[model samples]
Target chain A: MHPAPSVIVFTVLSGLGFGLLSFLGLGLPQVTGWEAFFYFALAFALAVGGLVASTFHLGNPQRALKAFTQWKTSWLSREAWLSSLALVAMGLYAFAAVFLDISAGLLGWLGAALSVATVVATSMIYAQLMTVPRWNHWLTPLHLLTLSLAGGAILAQQSAVALALLVVAGIVQILHWVLGDRRFEERGHTIESATGLGDIGAARLFEPPHTGTNYLLKEMVHVVGRKHAQKLRVIAFVFMIVLPIAVLILLPQGIVSAALAILCYLIGTFASRWLFFAEAEHVVGLYYGARSAQAVAG
Target chain B: MTQLPETSEKKLGLVIDLDTCVGCHACVTACKGWNTENYGAPLSDMDAYGSNPSGTFLNRVHSYEVEPRAGGCSQTVHFPKSCLHCDDAPCVTVCPTGASYKRQEDGIVLVEEDACIGCGLCAWACPYGARELDLAAGVMKKCTLCVDRIYNENLPEEDRIPACVRTCPAGARHFGDLGDPSSEVSMLVAERGGFDLMPEQGTQPTNKYLPPRPKDQLPDMDVLSPALEPVAGEPKGFLKWLDKALEAI
Candidate 1:
């Protein structure tokens, strides 16, 4: 749970891009001509760029193609397949709208549904992890969906819906943190239970497995300080929620202010996403003495 | 392709005795030595001879201090951890490619390095912290349970077990068909109350760990403890004389 930059960028940018495409596929804002072309092109570029960035995090990027074949069991594979379907459908829709000057109705609806499905699949990738108790909740998918919609609504310049959804997204974010905070302790597995030594007395780690950091320690045992996390939460709230709502309400309704709100929301989402990974406590960490009396407050 | 089989034919696994392990780390070293040579990528080391040395290891021994209970002395428990090869392995299900899988024939979990994208999701899904992503090879690595050694017809029958089990100095490691009720390991489990590491996780791990028996009830504790009964006036006069004579001699 290192919160690698590639993943943060992938989720944020792709979420925004797909959000925009979803709205456009539904024929929102009633725009046409070069302006429509520009919007479609920008959305495509963002989605594709975010996806391309994802491969940089992989050790064997060349073998990523094989990931598409295991859809029966792997959510990652399902994401790959659904995203491909969404991209292809959106591409055809874009071509018809810009070049042929005719966006077919069936293709438009199919593209929109696929776009939404792609985002859902992406969310499922993290939500399905039972090892990370904080993420193993139904609210994870809701958080992803609402945030994407809020971002999407802002991009489409639908002032009323964006403002309303932004407020909802903020509340959902706070609720998610509150619930996730309690998940670790609610899970009964502790060092005593993990080692099956509770029948005896207290169990304390006398020696770690190694002197230096290994792969498991580096990847799974990420710990964030409570004070720092609180500060980051405040920052995320101000940018993701307060600033966007303020700008949309106080500032004039136009492209410039809307763009600023979107930027702030994106930054806020990035911070929250970072916390998502940083705060997750993998059950394996119990073996490494990660649990303490106050572990729940983390 | 990453979906698990409905059932494995032979649930071959290790039954480790926590009481006997001395934290010698012989199994750790032997596993690294055998695996790096035989069937998988080299257990690569980074900055090995430098200020901070780190490396990939399939098995690791963790020592814990357990507080005394029931008038017993505090004990050091050497816990050797690796892949449990669970029946419901999340690692296999989470693999995007078919690289990470549990063998249907023998219940051995393996990583097919050739097909691996090295995304490291399998490592994240495993609660036992068994899998390690090899930085140099750009693929995930784990305890194969020494599949090559265990199944190799070339090796002597006595040596046909995992390298860790073979190298344990205390003879604490037992490997056999856990599926068979009559197997030695199953009987040991039944007798000693062998348990999984984290039963709540619901991984249904094939491996079982025999808990260290309570020290207070140990049959030899009375013999080991010092006793103070004077030999001079034990039974009678003749015995006393004999005891004194023996002591003087």
Candidate 2:
């Protein structure tokens, strides 16, 4: 809910970085020379920077070490574990490709698989939250994966592949938006269910727990105006998908055009991520008498 | 460590009566007063005595108006909400560090403050809004069910209950082991047809709420129809002559 800036940056940047690493791992079109070094540097910067940025959101960042110990049950721990593996493997693969001037096939494959797993683990962190019905669906992980692939393709300068994946990502984005809006109501929880008053009568919130905002209202029950959400969705779609596609199709394959597309895609993805958090309606909101599920939808 | 025990020896939880709660908020204040100092960290207030005064509270009472569909009179219900300490608690399982856990002995869910990294995931996992993040202490806090007092050997036996339960003016709150079939709370639940909150969420909450009993039926309007028969003769009384005398004057 709060859509903290650090988390947004972490998700988007890490997705792009891992996506790029996934492409390089496959050795698609035989990357070599200074190009390989450039790709490796960009991937490291995005992935490590994003991971480090995530720590800023923690209340006690120093105690985060214990987070790795609970991998048996916590997806957050799993993400940390997988990201470590991915980064370590990717580092070795980069050392071989850039310094030794040799293609490490096994290391590349391991790096690629772990990179993808890391993103999946990241998605699972949110997707596993049954309290937030919007993020509880399989569509959440699907959306995250598609975005990673699309962003990765763009960064890797794979025009044909990028265009194809971008279209797919765009379609998933629209579908997720359409579906996520109706998710809360589909769960069939009402004030009656929330308070266990279904057997007695129609229950409605007469008085809130407090006169002022509490942590639940501030964190879990964030309200975004419908009109503002719609406007943002359109802007997100235009910049994230439509403009990137337009730039790729209209301009020649070069550094300038690629950078432009990447910039627009990042901006668009950020807006879309913001909506992902903003539009999400936690089931706890039923106690607060939030408007109908359809109204909360983007 | 987050994995719940197969069976806890005791399921200590609160059973609140919807029929008797008066919405006085005594339990809320009582909880705040006791817990602010009992737990390791104080439940800090950000703007106390200021324009926007607010503080972290483990228990909060929410009042609702229930309009009966069967033409019964609308009733005001005061619902006090806190941690359910479910058999399968999502909050405990979602903790990245083994900080949030349910005790095996008493089934009381608690956060190990020393180990808690304060990621706030447990707060998100709770659908009941029972968990509150203490911004000042940089850790999550919640209803400990007066863990400090309930098992404190120093306290008087009668005063060992949770502060909320002890302070309830209407005696609407009951604290006992719901796991024991012979317990007073379990018998009360069986007799009153008590129900769990958000059963659909499948938390298997230890907390139970006894619904209000049906109201008594009122007399039909037709039963009083004969009383409205014309008081044909307001005559004969001394007051009748008084009206005529006033008119003549």
Candidate 3:
């Protein structure tokens, strides 16, 4: 699993954006007039900008419209549709709140539900991949959802709720890492099973198919050192959860403290998201004999 | 549609013989050559002939050393891999663009290049690493099983099979309707004890691989003792004279 920069940015920013939008839809902070306009603008920029950034990784962005057609089977398709619907519903809600000086009550609730669903859809894009054992877990969606809500609560200035959600997100993040570490081996994919040669003996890759790198090796066989990953995990936990909690609790309640907390949380979330993709071991690596017992154990 | 058909009319796939493959990569070459020119998009290479070359290949031959558990000797097995065209092809169902689909008619999974968004979800879904995103074409590529030539009536009847199967010098590759129990491939699988790769993955792969036969077995004979017998209990001509001369010296 290559920790593609574009995908990382998309998931992180969009998760935050949708989380913020969900809070806004519920009239958290209950901003009106210019304040409502400012919040909506910020939300739209983050959400739409993340969506645009996602297209950067696509080989053919021109044909991305076709991506919306396969929601019945594809999680990516569902994410696209859900995100678009969320944005549209939020846009209408924003227009009413900003211009008409009224809360489009039913529409705002619908938008909030869609916003959260969009984040779930995004998580499913990775969770549904059975080939990547680490991502194929019920905890994957739970981790993303918790992070989204926690980030949303912080942005909405719901300090008490944000503090609790942040604590839950931190616990879920640790649990995800602990369980995900064993998933590849637990899936029972090894060089022996991959090649169907365990009956003969222990199999090792004698010669690779090509001398040069291929797409599979480049994309799925990415190796992240265990020590480096461990350091990043601590950094992520501190910034995303601990620092935000400390800022909200210790510092006097002010816009400046909330801004600082948001900045710390975003940085931490980005680091964790990078690990999410980097640490994932796709089963295909077993065939290449790249994911050995030591690699899995790490 | 990205949704898989309930049942394919025919399970058309390859039966690879691990015993026979010499790791020549001839099938790989033939597949790349034929597919680039004939398929929806030409398979592309990035930084080719440079430091760090990479390309999209539908088929590749990997070699593995299997050490016998009984401790006789290690054997090198050449494993040629490509799309298994699984009955439960995960790649097909994961395609967001509906570009990837399995043909209900022939059971050959294919990527409709025009509709492809190049999101690469299909490639991620495949456990075999069967699908590769064509870097230049910006579309997914996989072993089509030579769909173009297999069904082309214009080609000579003998040349109708997949390019890999036809080009395999060792006859390691076989192509047929595995859905039909009476088919040559199905019978070959049954006779040779052919098995699927990663059966636990439960792809129910249409492709089958016949395991390699045991190697390095020898009869109970002291081969060196016969040579040590020294015909007629003496060294022959030159050897006999040399022995006498050496003894005198």
The whole-model lDDT of each prediction reads: 0.87, 0.88, 0.91
Q: What is the TM-score of chain B alone in each candidate?
A: 0.87, 0.90, 0.91
Q: Per-residue error at A128 for model 1, in Å?
A: 0.9
TM-score ranking of the models: 3, 2, 1
Per-residue lDDT tens digits of candidate 1, residues A64-177? 899988899998999899889999998888888887778667887888888888888888888898888888888888888788878888888888989998889888899889
Best by DockQ: 3
Model 2 clash number? 0
**Cα error, candidate 1, residue A35 (Å):** 1.1
lDDT of 1 at B126: 91
Residue-level lDDT of model 3, residues B85-149, one tens digit each, is 99999999888989999999988999988999898889999999999998998888999999999
- Please give me the DockQ of candidate 2 compared with the native complex: 0.75
lDDT of 1 by residue, B73-154 (tens): 7888999999999999999998998998899999999999999998999999898999999999989999998999888999
DockQ of each: 0.69, 0.75, 0.80
Candidate order by lDDT, decreasing, is: 3, 2, 1
Error of 3 at A7 (Å): 0.5
Clashing pairs in 3: none
| Share of true Cα-Cα contacts across chains kept by each model | 0.83, 0.74, 0.92
